[model samples]
Target: MFRLALKSLLNRRGTVLLTVFTIALSTALLVGVERVRSEARSSFASTLSGTDLIVGARAGTVQLLLYSVFRLGEPTANVSWATYQQIAAAPAVAWTVPISLGDSHRGYRVLGTTGAYFEHYRFGNRQPLAFAHGEPFAGVYEAVLGSEVAAKLGYSLGDDIVIAHGIGRVSFSNHDDKPFRIAGILAPTGTPVDRTVHVPLAAIEAIHLDWQSGTRLPGRGISAEQALTHDLTPRSITAFLVGLKSRVATFQLQRQINEYRGEALSAILPGVALQQLWSLTGVAENALRLVAACVVIVGILGMSTALLTTLNERRREMAILRSVGARPRTILGLLCLEAMSLTLAGIVLGVLLLYAILAAVRGYAASQFGLFLGLGLPTAAELYALAAIFSAGLVAGMVPAWLGYRRSLSDGLAVRT
Candidate 1:
């Protein structure tokens, strides 16, 4: 039966091939979307794996995560440097790394942080930050470039780069006088960190010393040397990441920060905040899955349509098999085998194509889009999705197979023009 089905499909290779290609494309779409969706969530979850709580001015948890960790938006307010220090001094707090934003260098965000950032910040299974070249910023006038920033801007250690006053790419008020020398370049982290420029928190204060209202004060010149002599301590910071001495005290510390009397503050568990983000994004993810599923259905239906259309043309063939004492059930099984074979072939091709495309674009996706796609075996979820597609194909083919079984040998062998 399998051999006969194979020969029959070979005889109509044109239509069969087209049907297989259609199914292959849809299967690829379904599995590809699933892979990207899963990877994106994994990436987002791992973006701050080592951090316990992210503390910032009172705002929505997701909003705080967006601006603090992802650099997606502006902070609602800043935490006083005094408040940050107080929190750092908490007994339960093991360490805290303050982050000050509101500056940019040529479209990339400038992150004002301390050397502890490199030591504490982590991604992808508690991986520590490593330097691709040079070391962390040491001096007030020095800067560290993320891997992406260095590569994209063609900057290296000892190169002087000016910091802009605001987040805009084109700033009318530039701190050209106090340009920073590149002190370090961090390895690619495949997170928002890659797109950031790291500098001491004091660098943020030093650049804004001669500026007011988001512009450089005219006729008021403070040379880099002169600015260094003056106070460069930051008055406030956008947010801070906190690590606890004991995991059991996380909730206690979070509650304390939320109820602090000096100012309104919010502290969130990074894991919980990430789950909130997933909840918000789940709708769109499901919509994409639904669309992929619809495409798969269309492909399966097209295959069934093709099979039904060919039943008429193969009537004489069916009659010949029936005359040879082949049971109607045998004819049905042949059609069913053909459908399963086509589906299996399509699935194999689609998986191969998916991995091929992923291998070719994996680096590009990581560097350009911050999307990390592993070129590993298909995940269990992906395997399940493929199995579901194959099963649907089997059920779809049964429609045509049933109709073929219902056909009488006399009806097929009847004389027709």
Candidate 2:
């Protein structure tokens, strides 16, 4: 039966190839989307699991996460260093890292914090920032660039760059006189950290010391040397990344921190905020999945339509099989086998195509977007899609198979489709 089916399909290679190609492209779409969804989900969960609470000015949970973790927006009001100190001094607080963000070099955000940031701030399940170049920056005028910033700005160890105040489309003030030398370059962390520049919190104050209202002290120029001697108090910090002393105290800490009287501040669990984000995005995700399923259905329908339409032309062929004492069931099996074979071929083609695309853009995607797709054999999602396709093919073929069987039954040697 299998040999007969193969020979029948081989004789109709042109039409069979088209049907298989259709199924293959649909399978690829289904598999590719699933891969992105899986990897993106894994990336989001692993990125911020270590932080117990992210403290910032009173804002929506998503807003706070956007500003603090992804650097998508600025805090409306910064928590004063005094407030940060109070939080750090709390018995419930295991450790704290102050973050002061405002400046930018080109497009990458510059973070002002202490060495404690590098020590405690984690990504992907408490994964520490690994260095690719020198150690952490110690001097006020030294900077550590993230992998993305280094690659984008063509910066390396010992390179100096000016900081610009305010993350605007354009800025008039530049800290050119007090340029910072790159002390280290961090390895690719696959998070927002990969695109940030890190310097001591004091450096943030140092650069803005001689300036007022986002410009140099006009008619009162203070040299970088003279500016160093003067008091540079940072009025506020963008936010602080906090870790709790005990895992059980998360709720207590969140409630305590949100009700703090010092400022309109709030603390949110990174994981919870991410869940909220996914919940919001779930509608669109489902819509996309539905569309993909429809595409697969259309492809299967196309295969069924092609086979059914050709029944009249192949009616003579069916008659010959019946004359050779091939049962009506044999003819049905042959038709069903063709559809299943087409679906399987399509699965193989689509997978091979995806691998080719991944190979072509592996470096570009990683360097430009920091998205690293791990190439391997079929994931469970791909396997599931393949199974679904084959099943759909079988169901689709059954209709035409039944039609062919009936025609063969009615006209054993004189067929009419």
Candidate 3:
């Protein structure tokens, strides 16, 4: 019976192949959507691993998170250097990495932070930032380039690069006098860090020595060497990352920073803020899944239509089988088996197709969009989804199966008329 069913499908190979292709495309889409969502959440969550709290001037929690971690927007105000000192002095604080933004090199963001950022900041399972070449900046005029920044800008160690006075790519004023030499290039971390330029906090102050209230003072130009000779204390900073002495003090410290009287401040748990950000933007992910589901339905419907239409043309074949001692139940099973076979083939083909496409584009995706896609077996939920699709295929075949049974019964009872 199985051989007969296989031969029968081969006889209508054109329609069968089309149905298989449609179902395969649908399965690929379903699996692809689930993988993207899963990896996106993982990538985002891993970007700030092991950080206890993100402290910034008073602002919306999401806003603070966006500016501090993602480097999305400008801060409304900066926390005073005095306030930062107090936060770092708290007994519950294990360490603090102060960050100063607002400078740009070409189009990439320039981050002014202490060497502590390299030692304390981590991502992806407590993974410390690793250098691809050379070491951290040892002088105020030295800089380290992120992997993407180095690649895109074609920068190498010992190359002198000047930063612009503003954050935009089209800045009118450039800090031409205080060019920094590339000291290191960091390995890719698949996070925003991959797109940033790192320098010591003193470098930030050095570049602005002749400026006050967001503009350079007239006739007060100072050379980089002269600026370095002065006290380069940062009066304020954009935000800071905090590590706590213990997990139990996380909430306690967050509350303390929120009610801080020295300045208007806000402290957020990175994990909690990340969850809120996802919840706010999760509609897009859900929408993609919905579209994929609809495509799967369309594919199943095409398969059912092909089967139902084939039943009419195969009536004579059904009569011939009935004459050969085949029961009506046998005809029904044959139709069901054909449908199940097509669906199973499609699921397998789709999985193979997905992996092939991912392998081809994985490098491009990571470099272009910072999305790192892993090739692995389907997750348990994905396996369940495939099983549901198979079950749906069987149900789809029932209509044609029932018609074949009735056709067999009628062929057995028909007269010459």
Candidate 4:
């Protein structure tokens, strides 16, 4: 029966092949959406691990997280340097790394922070940042490049690079006088850290010394040497990352920071804030999944239509088989087997295509979008989706199977046109 089914499909290879390709495309779309969505969530969740609280000027927690951690947007307001110091001085606080934004180097964000950032910042299962080349920035005139920044710009240790005044890629107000030499190159962490340029907090201050209101002061230039002789203390920073002495003090310190009398502030637990961000994005994710599912349905319907059309052309073949002692049920089973074979072949082809595309674009996706896709075995959710698709295909085949049974009985002992 299986041999007969195989030959039957081979008889109409052209249509069968097209049907398989359509189904393959749909299967790929469905599985690909799930894979990318799952990996994106994992990447975001692991970006800021081991941090207890993120303190910043009063704003939405999600907004603060996106700007401070992911570098997606700008801060609504700056937190005073004094406020950051007070938060760091809290009895329950173990360490704090102040983040000063508002600078860019060739489209990548330049993050001005202290050495404590390398010592305390964690990601991806409490993993500490590691250097692939030199050491962390220790001097105000030096900088450390993230893996992506170094590779994309072809920068090496000791290469001098000028930072721009604002976050835009093209800035007319470039800090040309005080260019920073590359001090270190960090190893890739598959997080946003891989895209940042790290510099000492004082570097941020030194570059802005001769600027006012986001522009260089007219005819009043502070040379790099002269700027160093003056106070380089930062007046304000974008935000700060805080680690607690104990897990128990997290909530207490968070409450204290939120209610501080000196300034309007907000402290958020990193895990909670990350969850909120994911929930907010859930709507769009679901919509994508729905679209993929609809395409799969359309593909299945196309396969069904192909099968129904083939029944008319094969009526004479059905009559010959019945004359050769084939039962109605046997004819029905043969048609069903052909359907299953086509679906199974499509699934295999789709899976192979998916892995091929993943291998080709994995590195580009990580570099361009910070999305890391791995070529591992399908997750349980993916397996379930495949199984459900196979079941639906089987059910769809039953309709043609029933019609073939009735047609075999009616057309027996006579060759139909």
Q: Model 3: per-residue lDDT, tens digit, 307-330?
A: 999987887788888888898999
Q: Which ten residues in a row have the lowest lDDT in candidate 2?
A: 408-417
Q: How high is the CA lDDT of each candidate model?
A: 0.92, 0.83, 0.90, 0.90
Per residue, candidate 1 scores C-alpha lDDT tens digits across 170-213 of 88777899999999999988898999999999888888888888
Report how far off residue 96 is in candidate 3 (Å): 0.2
Point out where model 2 deviates above 4 Å.
168-173, 367-369, 409-417
Ranking by lDDT: 1, 3, 4, 2
TM-score: which is higher, 1 or 2?
1
TM-score against truth, every candidate: 0.97, 0.93, 0.93, 0.98
Pairs in clash, predicted candidate 2:
none
**lDDT for each residue of candidate 2 in 44-160, tens digit (9 for 90 to 100):** 676665788999999999889888888787787888888888888988888888899989888678899899888997888678988999989988889999998898778889999
Of candidate 4, the 10-residue stretch with the lowest lDDT total is 408-417
Best prediction by lDDT? 1
Please estimate how well model 1 matches the true structure, expressed as its whole-model Cα lDDT.
Answer: 0.92
User: Taking the candidates one at a time, how many backbone clashes does each contain?
Assistant: 0, 0, 0, 0
| lDDT accuracy of residue 84 in candidate 4 | 86
Of candidates 4 and 3, the better by TM-score: 4
Clashing pairs in 4: none
Q: What TM-score would you give candidate 2 relative to the actual structure?
A: 0.93
